[model samples]
Structures are given as structure tokens and as C-alpha cells.
Target: MLTELHIRHFAIVKSLDIEFRNGMTAITGETGAGKSIALDALSLCLGSRADASLVRPGCDKAEITACFAVAKDSPAARWLAEQDLDAEDECVLRRIINKDGRSKAWINGSPVPLAQQKSLAPLLVNIHGQHEHQLLTRDEHQLHLLDQFARHNHLLEATKAHYRQWADTEKQYRQQQQAKADREAQRQLLEYQVGELDEFALAEGEFEQLEADHKRLSNHRSLDEASLFALNALYEGEHNNANGLVQSAGQRLQESVDMDPQLGSINELLKQAMVHIEEAALELRHYQDQMHIDSAELETIEQRMTQALKLAKKHQCSAAELYPLHQQLKSELQTLIATDEASEQLAEQRQTLRQAYREQAKKLFDSRQRAANQLSDKITSAMQQLNMPHGRFEISVDHDNQAPATAKGTDQVQFLVSANPGQPLQPISKVASGGELSRISLAIQVMSATQQTVPTMMFDEVDVGVSGPTAAVVGSMLRELGGQCQIICVTHLPQVAAKAHQQLQVAKHTDGKETQTDVRALNNDERVVELARLLGGDKVTDLTKANAKELLAS
Candidate 1:
């Protein structure tokens, strides 16, 4: 239940703090006196959209805080625990709206996204606005109300889940059917391309080796000439050959070694140089013997390289990538082959899901039928109390087996009513007058409230088109509802205001420079005065006061 509300700089409310108790509370004020200011503030804390105009004229920001007493096992408590924002059995929701229309929300002093507050709002408070009855004309709203009345959340969720799964599988099946021919064509093309690549069978690193051999063979003549010239110059040449010259220099250095020890080291270096030259000459002679000019081998390598380049270009890759591309195509072909088998499997799965969806939807349809009958009886009874003694109310739950499945199932729910005696039942939207609609809307709301698990319900002038004894009945109904949960109503009717266990009077005060709206809890005497004012308008007569007292005594 809501415990307290603290609002500052919101609308004409400069600052207000109000404590709430565990029964019906009526908020009353003159026209334009901002009777709904507290409701508006609470809405902001409950994650309603914010506007800069809601801030007081000269204030930088508007702030609203709402505190609730949460049962340990209530939905709000569980949600708070899940969000790691639990504060024992108390939950505080705060909202701050700046003049620029930017807003921030907090739960238990921890900042949170506005969406988080929105998600938690329904679990804490259920607000019925003045214009909520206008939505009753909509078919979707009617269906939603029926479902809420039914309270078969688990069955509805299961139906929705099955519908989604079936719909998804159906979509896949249709897409696969449409793409079957294209898939077959692709498979044939892949088979041909993969076959060609397999026949070529290029090994890894073979291209580079082939290129090296091709270069070597193409330059074999020049290589042979160079090696023969080097061999003769180093070892085979008899006149002034490198080996003969180095040997003569080493012998001269050895003869002078006895005269100078440094000359001995120079002679050893000359001997090492001569040995290196002789070994190099022998290597050159071996290379010259191994070198050959083979035109046929060169042509064969060239042809192979040409084919590799052609294949690489066709596949949009380099010659070295042909082997990898071939393996990738093979994998794709295998997957496409497996997809054919998967299509059959998916067909079977779709049939199974379709059957499952039908079963769940049927269960939901049956539940709606049962709930519709009970709700119709209750609303009809409530209508008689609201001054429509001859009114007949009924709920039509029609299930179409041939209709395509939807997340909400195949049930069409409509509210039918006959507001006058001898009138045939018709759709409420087409038959009920504005006043009748308001009362019917109120009856539905009352019924919905009883089924709600939330601890607090706020009605914002839902008694708009009701007056006389009907207004008193509405008030009494709200008071009775308060016995089960907290009820806060913003109303103008004195009958309604007098029925509340507590009354709050809203008054607008203005100076030359500023206007402010104030809300104060009304004591018994003050409540009498307020009720008298409501009864007699701006002038509170002695007769009106007496009547106010009489209304209160009832």
C-alpha cells in the first residue's frame, strides 16, 4: 500500500507532503484547483512521461517521491529483490524532471532507467485515469480486459510461445520451399566446379617450387657459361691462375718468417686463402657438370603454370590459393546436400509445432469462455446497483477454428449490453449512452481492481458522468474496495467525497507574482466545510452545511 507522497515544484504545487492510510481517500477541489496534482506526481514516480511544463513557473525542476509498504511475497517485493534494490519491506520510487524535459528515476536510492520504473509500476500501483473508459470502445482493449479478468497468465503465455514457435517454423518452411529450385541449381554448379578442382589436384607449396625450377632451366645456358669461366680462372687456368699466385705468395712469406714473426702470420693467411679458392673451383666444376638446357622440361613447367594461373583467375584468387578454395567449395557442397535433408526435418517440426499451438490456443479459448460468463454476470449485477435496474450485460467469446493463429489466440471477445428495458442486447460501443458507458466502465474497473494483486489503486475522476444516487453507489463501491486494498480517488461529487474514510482538499492560492496549489488532509470539521462547498458551489449556505453533515452521517 502507498504510505506517503512528497512532491515539490510540480505543476502549481510548490511543496506538498501527504500521508496515506489503509482505506479509501477522496481528493476534492474546485475546478482548476489542481485536484489531480497528487495523482500526477505519483504518476511521474511511477514512470509516466515527463514535461517541462509540469515544473513550477520559477522552479528549476520538479521532484516526486512515492513510498509503499511491500509484502514480502508481493510482486513488487520480488521485483525489487531481482533488481538488487530491495529495502526490506519498504519501496521508495522517486522521479526528478528538469525544466528541459529531461527526467531521472530512482528506486531505493539507486538510479535506474525510466523503463525499469515502468516495468515495476504495475506491480506497485494501478492508476485508472478519467478518460480510461474511452478505450472500452476498442476491440483490442476489450480482449485485453477479458484476459485480465480471466487471470490465466500462464495459459496465455504458453499459447503465445507456441504460436511464435509455429510461426517461425512456418516462415522457414515457406522460404525453403521457394528456394528449392535455386538450391538445386547451386548444388549442380558446385559439383562441376569441385570436380574440376579435384582433377587438377595442385599440392601445397608446389607452385613456388615449380616457379623456381622454371627460372633455373630458362637461364641454364648463361649459368653454364658463368660456371665454366669461374672454374678455369680459379683452378683450370695455367698462366697466373689464382691458386698458383696464392701459393707463390705463401712460399715467399714462409722464407721471411725467420726474419720477422709477423711475416709468418701473413704466410698462414695466404695458405688459407689458397685452400678456399681451390675448394670453390671444385664446386664450380660440379655445378657446370650438373647444369643442362632442356627445352621439353621448360615447356612442360610453363604449361603447368599457365593452367594454374588460368584456374586461379577463374576462381578470383591467386595460383597459391587454388587448393584452399577447392576445400572450401567441397565443404559448401556438403552443407547444401545436408540442407535438403534438413528441409524434410523442418517440415515435420512445423507440423508438430502447429499441433502444439492449436492445443494451447484451445485451452486458452476455453478459459476465456468460462471467465467471460462469470464477468458478464458480475457486471450485470453492478449495473443494476448503478441505477440501471433493467440493464443486461453479456460477454461474447467467439473462437474461430479456421482463423490463423495469433499470439493472443483465436478468441474474439466483445462486451454486449442493453441499457434499457425491452431493448435487445447490442455491442456496448454502439448502444450505451455516455453516462451508461461511464458506469459500465466503472463496473469493469471495479471488477478488474478486485482481481489485481497490486496494493494501491488510484481512480482519477472515473465518476465523471455519474451523480445523484449513482455517485453515492460509486463511492460506496470504492470504499468497499478499500477494505481489501488502498483506494485513492480524485472526485468532484460531494456524495463521493463524503463516503471516503479520509478527505483531502486542494486549494489554489495566488499572490501578484506567483500561484501555488496546496493539498491538506481534512479533519472532520474541515471535511464538512469542503463537502458543503462542493454541495453549494462557491457559496456555502447553512442548508448546504446541514446537507453535507447528513451525507457524512450516512
Candidate 2:
């Protein structure tokens, strides 16, 4: 319930602080006595769109703060917990709007976005007035009310989950099908790619080796000529060969060594030279053997190397990457095949989920239809008590053909009413006058209040169109509702005011040239006088006061 409200520099309200009590609290004053100002300030705290024009003429900013003490299990507290804000026995919402067209909001002194503040506002309070009659006028809201009345939140949640799954599956199925269809045009290219890569079958390190071998083989005749010339030079014909020359030198040195001691060192050096020349001659012969080249084998190597290069270019990769590319393509092909199976499986799962959703939706629709009827009947009865005795009301639950097959079991709910006897029942928005609609709106709210979980419900002049016995019944209904939840009503009806547990009289006082609104809680005597004023107008005669006292006593 709203515990307090503080407003500053907002519209006609310069500064005001009022503490509200539980149960029915009435705010009454003359038409322009700022009764609606208080409600407007409360609306500001609830995150309503702010305008710089709402600020006092001479002030830089306007501010409003509302304090609520909610039960631990109340939805407001639960909402606060979800927002990670302070939900401790009390919650405070504050909003400030600067003259520069900027606004800021806070929840429990913690800064928050306006949207979050708005979401939490409904949990704490419901301010129903002429504008909100649209809620009762809409079919979707009727369905929502029915769902709320039935407390089918768990089943509704299950339905939503099923919806999400069904939607996700449908999206996935479409995407996969589209992808498969698009891939059709690329199928020939993909297969050709796989086949071309497979044919080359290039081996690692083969390219570099082949290039070197090709160069050598391409100059095979020249290489043979060079090897033969080298061999001839190293171990030339018979007597001119390097080995024969070295042996001759060694034999001459050995004969000299027998004649002179210096010849001994010369003979050792000659023997070493002879050994090196013979080794060189053997290496030349080995080189000649290795130079043997076959033209046919060389052609085969060249052709394979050229094909490998061509395949690398066609695939936009190097020859070494061709093997890995083949593996990648094969793996992708395998995945495509597996996706076909998985898609079929998902389709089956989707069908199963769709069936479950259908069952749940049908159950939900049936429950709403029943709840709607009950709600309609209850509201109609209450409307008769509110003085529209001839008002005919109906809760129209019509089937909607435009609803998707997957929709929550195809029911479109609407509220219809007729304010006059024998008149055709029309949609609530069409058949009800403004004031008649006001009472009907109040009746609808009063009927739903017992089932709604909100802690506080405010009705701005709910008795606007009601009088006499109807006003008395409206007062009784409010009093009864106040016992269950906090109720605040702004009304000109003395009957309604007389039944309130507490009455806060709003009066305007002039300080010099400025008029300010002040709210005072009325005591028993004051309540009688205020009620008398509402009943008897400016002339609160002794008889009228006595009558007011009698009304209060009753």
C-alpha cells in the first residue's frame, strides 16, 4: 500500500507531503482543488512520461516520490527482487524532471531506467480512471483477466514455452530447407571439385623433388657429356691418365731416394699425391654411372608435376594442401547427409511439441471461456447495483479465423454492454456513455479486485456517475474491497465518502496572492462536516449536518 507521497514544484502543487493509510482513504474538494493533482504526482512517481511544462513556473525542476510498504509475498516485492532493487518491507520510487527536458528516475534510491520503473509500478498500484476503461474495452485484456482469475500461470507458462519451442523449430526447419535448396545449384560444382582434387593425388615434398629431377633430366645429354669429359681428364687415355702420371712420379722419387737422403721425404709426398688422384678417378666413374637418365621416365615425371600445379591453381590452394582439402570436402559431405537425418528427427520432434501445445492451448482456451463468463456475469450484477439496472452486459468469446493454427486454441474474447433496455448489445467502447462507462469500468474493476494480486487500487472518482442508493452500494463495495487491499477513492459522492475508514479533505488556502492545496485527515466531527458539504453543498445547514451524522453512524 502507498504509505506516503511527496511532491514539489509540479503543476499547481508547490510542495506537499501526505501520508496515506491502509483501507479506503477519500480525497474530496472542489472541482479545481487539486484532487487530481495528487493523483498526477503519484503517476509521475510511477514512471509516467515527464514534461518540462509540468514544472512550476519559477522552479528549475519538478520532483515526486511515492513510498509503499508491501507485504513480503506481494507481487511488488517480488518484482523488486527481480530487479535487484531494495524490496525490504518498503519501496520508494522517485522521479525528477528538469526544466531542460531531461528526466531521471530511481527505485529505492537506486537509479533505474524508466521502463523498469514502469514495470514495477503496476505491481504496487493500479490507477484506473477514464483512460484505463480501454483495458476493459479490449478483448486481449479480457483474456488476460480470465487467465489471471483462473490463476493458470503455470499452464500459461508451459504454453509459452511450447510456443517458443515450436517457433524455434519452425525457423530452423525453414532455414535448413532453404539452405539445402540453395545448395542444389552448387552440387555439380562441389562434386567436380571433389573429383578434380582426388585425381591429382599429389604427394607431400614430391613437387620440390620433381622440379630438381626435371632440371637434371632436361639437361641429360649435356650432363653425360660433362661426366665423360671429367672422367677422361682425371684418368685420361692410358699413359696420360692422372693415376699413371702419379705412379710414374712415385717410382722416379723412390729410385732417387736410394741415391740421396733428401729423396726419402720427396718419395712420401709423391705417394700421397698418387692416392688422391686414384680416389678422384673412382669418384668420376661413380658420377658417370649416376648420370644414366631415361627419357620416358622423365616425361612421366614432368607430366605429373604439371598436372599437380594445374590442380593447385584450380582449387585456389597449394599442391601440398590438396590432400587436406579432399578430407575437408568429404567431411562436409558426410555432415550434409547427417543433417538430412537430423532434420527429419527435428521435424518429428516439432510435430510432437505442436501436439502437446494444442492440448494445452485447448485446455487454456476452455478455462478462459468459463472464467470470462463468470467475470461478465459478476460485472453485470455489480453494474446493476451501480444504478444501471437495465444495462445488459455480455462477454463475447468468438472464434477467430485469422489466428494461426499454432495459436493458443483460437478464441477471441470481447466485452459488450448495452446501457438501455431493449437496445442491442454493442462493444463496450460503442454502447456506453462516458459516465455510464465509468460506473461499468468501476464494476469491472471491483469484480476483479478480489482476484487481482496488486496491493493498492486507486479509483479516480469511481462514483462520478452514481448517486442515491447506487452510490451507497458503490461505497459498500469499496469498503468491502478496502478490507482486503488498500483502496483510495476520489469522489464527490457523500455516500462513498461517508463509508471510508479515513477521509482526507483537500482544501485550498491563500497565502498572500498564491493559492496552495493542503490535505488534512478529518476526525469524526470533521468527517461529518465534509460529508455534509458533499451532500448539502455550500449551505451545510444544521439539518444537513444531522443528516450527514446519521449517514456516518449508519
Candidate 3:
């Protein structure tokens, strides 16, 4: 339950500190007395959005803090543990909004994201404002309420899991089917690519070697003629040869050796030179005899090289990459063919999952039917006690065939009310008056007592459109609910105010220059005065005071 609330520079509230306690507490004041302001501040602390306009005129920022004390084994204790925040027995939630639309939130005095703060709220407090009753018309909330009443969360979770699997399988199946039309076209393209590349059959390093061989073959005659001429001039000449000339020189030098001793060294050098010339003449004869040219082989090499270059250009790759490209294309085409087969297999699995989801959804439908029957009875009884004697409540669970399998279920639930006898039961949103709706909402709340998750509930003017005996019953319902958990109600009805275990009266005053709102816990005498004021407007007559005293005594 909420322990304390503090508001600073929030709206017209400069600074306010209020301590709350167990049981039902009534907050009452005249029009424009800031009764809604207190609820607004509490809502902010409970993770509602904050705006710059909420700040006081002269203040730079607005702050609201709510403190809660929970049991050791409560959901909040586990939440704090999960978040790694400091937790003892109490949790403090604080929110601050600056004048520039910037805001901050804290959990247990540790800085936290706004989403974390919002996540923590449902476990601590449940606030039902005037507009919240409109949720009765929504399919999701109606199904949610049915599930809560049924206490079948485990089964609901199973249904959701099965539905998700079915949904995902269906999605993949659709995508693959959409691609099937293009699959054949793509496969043919890849096959053609593979065939084109295969014609090259070029080996690594073969392109360079072939180019070199072709060049040599093309210049074969020129190379042979040049070598033969050079050899004839040096050694194969018919008139004179290099070997004979060198031998003649050596003989002449030997003859001159008799005249000079230095001529003997020159004769030996000429003899060695004649031996090298004779070796060169033998090699030139072998070279001239071995030369042979083939034009056919050269033409074949040129054709092969041209084909390799053309294939490389068409594939946007080098001549050496054609073989690898062929292998890659073959692998991709094979996979595409396999995908068509795999897609059929997945379609069969999707059907299986859909069947599973249908079985799970049927179970949910049966559970909701049973729960809705029991809830309708309980709420109808509650409405009778709330002064709607002729009112009838009904829950319609209609099957929705066209709804998605992954949605809440195959059922569309709606709440209907007939406020008077002979009036056909119509949708709650269309037929129930504001006062009747308030009572119906109260009835539903009372019926789902065990399903309430939080230990604290605040009803902001739940008695707004109710008065007379209905207002008294509304107060009784709130007091009865207080026995199980804390209840805070802001109201303008004396019947409701007089039933509270504690009453806080909000009043505003101006000191000629500044206006301020204050909330003070009313004593027994003060309660009478406040109740009398509520009953008689600004004039608390003796009869109204007596009536107020009688209500307090009861």
C-alpha cells in the first residue's frame, strides 16, 4: 500500500506532504479545490507522462514522489531484485519534470528509465479514473478480464506460443511461394552462365604460357634466318671459315717466334682462340638444321587465346577465374532447385502448427465461456446491491472466424447491460447511462476481487454520477473493498465521505497576493462540518449537521 506522497512545485501545489494508511480514505473539497490535483500528482508518481505545463508558474521544475511498503515475498520485491536496485521493505518511486519538457524517474532512489518505472506501477497500485470504464468496449481488455477471471494464464501462454509458431511459419511459407515464380527464371540464367564459362576450360597459368608460345611461333621464319646468317659469317662461310683463319694466324706467329721471344705467348693465345672458333662452327650447323615452323599450331594457339579473353570480358572476371566461376554457378543453381523442394516441406509444417494452434485456442474458448458465465452472475448480483434493482448484465462471446490465429483468440467478447426490465440488453458503451456505467464498473470490480493484482487502489471520483441511495451503496462497496486492500476515493458525496475511515478535506485560501491549496485530515467534529458542507453547499444548516452526525454514527 502507498505510505507517503510528496509534491513540490507541481501545478498550483507549492509543497505538500501527506501520509496515507490502510483502509478507505475519502478526499473531498468544493469545485476547483484541487481534488483532482492530488490524484494527478499521484498518477505522475505512478509513471504517467509529465509535461512542462504541470510546473508552477514561478518554479523551474515539478517533482512527485510515492513511497510503498511491500511484503518480503511480494512482486515488487522480486521486481527490484530483478532490476538490481537496492531493496529493503519499502520502494520509492519519484518523477521530476523540468520546464523544458525534460523528465527523470527514480526507483528506490536509484536512477531508472521511465519504462522501468512504468513496469513497476501495475504491481504496486491500480488507479481507475473516470474514463477507464470505457475499456469495457474493447475486445482485448474484455478477453483479458475473462482470462483473469478464469485464472488460466498458463493455458493462455501456451496458446500464445503455439500461435506465434504458426504465424512465423505462415510468413516464411508466403515469402517462399512469392519467390517461386521467379525461381525458374533465375535457375535458367545461372545454367546459361555455367555453360558459357565451361567452354573456356582454361587452366591456371595456361593463358600466359599460350601467349608466349604463339609469339615464338609467329616469328619462327625471322628467328631462323637471323640465326643462320650470323652463324655463316662467323664459321660456316664457303670461301673462308673463322677456324682456318685463326689457325693461319697461329702458324705465322710460331714462325716469328724465332725472331722474338714475346711472339711465343701470342702464338699460344691464337691456338686456344682457333679451338673455340671450331666449337662455334659445329653449334651453328646444328642450329641451322634443327629450325622448323608450323602455321597450323600457331593459328590454334591464337584462337584459344581469343576465346579465353572474350569469356573473361563477358563474365567481368580474369581469364584465370572462369573455372572457379563455373563451379560457383553450378552450386547456386543446385540450391535454387533444392529450395523449391524445401518450401513444400515447410508449407506442410505450417499446416501442422496451425492445427496445434486451433486446438489450443479451443481450450481457451471453453475456459472463457465458463468464466464469463460465472462473472456475469456475480456482477448482476453486485449491481442489484448497488441500487440498480432492475439492471441486467450479460457477456457475449461471439466467434470471430476472420480474426488472425495469433490474436487473443477466435472469440470476440463484449459486455452488455439492460438498465431496466423489458429493455433489450445492448452493448454497455451504447446503452448504459453515465451513472449506470459507473455502477456497472463497480460491480465488475467487485466480481473480480480475487483477480486484483495490486494492494492499493485509487478511484478518482467514482461517485461522480451517483447520489442518494446509490451513492451510499458505492461508499459501502469501497469500505468493503478496504478490508482486503487499501482504498482511496475522491468524491463530492456526503454519503461516501461519511463512510471513510479517514477524510482529508482540500481547501484553498489566498493571502491577498498568493493562493495555495492544503489538504488536512478531518477529525470527528471536522468531518461533520465537512460532510455538512458537502450536503448543504456553502451553508451548513443545523439539520444538515444533524444528518451528517447521524451518517457518522451509522
Highest TM-score scorer: 2
Q: Write the per-residue lDDT of candidate 1 for residues 98-139, one digit (tens) a residue.
A: 999999999999999999999999998999999988898889
List the candidates' TM-scores in order: 0.79, 0.83, 0.80
TM-score of 1: 0.79
Deviation in angstroms for 442 in model 2? Answer: 1.6
Which residue pairs clash in candidate 2?
none
Task: Please give the clash total of every predicted structure, in order.
Answer: 0, 0, 0
Q: Write the per-residue lDDT of candidate 3 for residues 213-315, one digit (tens) a residue.
A: 9888888889888878777766777756676677788888888999998999988898888777777767877877777777788889989989988988988
Order the numbered candidates by lDDT, best leading. Answer: 1, 3, 2
Leading candidate by lDDT: 1
Measured on C-alpha atoms, candidate 3 has an lDDT of 0.84
RMSD of each: 4.9, 4.6, 5.4
lDDT of 2 by residue, 66-176 (tens): 999978887788888887996689999999999987999999999999999889888898887745576776767777666666667777777787877878888898887
* Cα distance off (Å), candidate 1, residue 112: 1.0
